[model samples]
Target: MAEEGVMAHIPINHPARPVYRVLAGLIGLYIVVFGVFGLVETAGDDFFSRGSHWVLGLRTNMAFALVSVIFGLVVLFGAVHRGNLGHLMNLTAGVVFLVVGLAMLTVLQTEANILNFSVSTVIVSMLFGLVLLATGLYDKVGPPEHAETEREMRSSSSARPGR
Candidate 1:
């Protein structure tokens, strides 16, 4: 019952699912490109240096660039895959991006900022997080019959008085 309740809340076979998936993929591609540029720009710099290197309008260092490339690849994998794997990856990536953005924002003025994230980077991360979260919420996949059943259940549940 609990699982059914949870499933009922998520949209299956949504019309905009493909768009969301493509958007996620695009975000991933952007991140990958940024990371690559960052790596090139930060070459010969210290791994965690608070240098003046910027990539795609965001500050970066060798360490952060490497992390970005790896993380972006993971996101790309999630976007490319089908079914619950993509859903789970997107949800996890969204939470990670949001957390990283907040954490970077807090340390923007301190030496603890290992990634050398600028304000713009933080903003972009938060925006990407929101988009990924929204995509995940409505990215469920299921057969037409299941979608129909889910729709009926949702309608019936909404029609009933407070139960």
Candidate 2:
């Protein structure tokens, strides 16, 4: 049998507002990075210097990046207003971005023989996803002072009861 690993808390209840604010800012930065990268890719064929176009083309990547930026904006708003649902929406977007990032990596791996992604690019994407996941998990817990936020989220949920 394998040993179990302890689950880590997201520190949502650290009694400090700065952490959340910092997280929002960081997420926003990540969103901008993606958006900029996508736009650049679209604007030029050799954006990555890999000499090969992304599977969906630079335009498609730009769209995905732009969506990610929008999601980040929502997250920032949530952090500022302390809205639980807004944070959840951000988490959802982050999750989507993570999945897409993974898919992008897999695609790159398949096309490695033709073109390769830089080590930094892979590391950055993976790290970004991990960050988003950690933050989302923390938001889900809503520990300590965030109980109200959590409750508001439950009450406002669109899901039917007893599903």
Per lDDT, the best of the predicted structures is 1
* TM-score of candidate 2 versus the correct structure, residues matched by position: 0.50
TM-score of model 1 (CA atoms): 0.92
* lDDT scores of the candidates, listed in order: 0.90, 0.53
Question: Which ranges in model 2 have alpha carbons more than 4 Å from their true place?
Answer: 1-17, 37-68, 71-75, 110-119, 140-163
Alpha-carbon lDDT of model 1: 0.90
- Candidate 1's residue-wise lDDT over 17-104, tens digit each? 9999999999999999999998999999999999899888899999999999999999999888889889889988999999999999
Best model number under TM-score: 1
Listed in order, each prediction's TM-score against the native is 0.92, 0.50
lDDT of 2 by residue, 1-163 (tens): 2224532323344344456446756766656666666656656444233443343223234445556567657656654555456456556656765776676667664643222443344555566666655555555435454655644555677476774
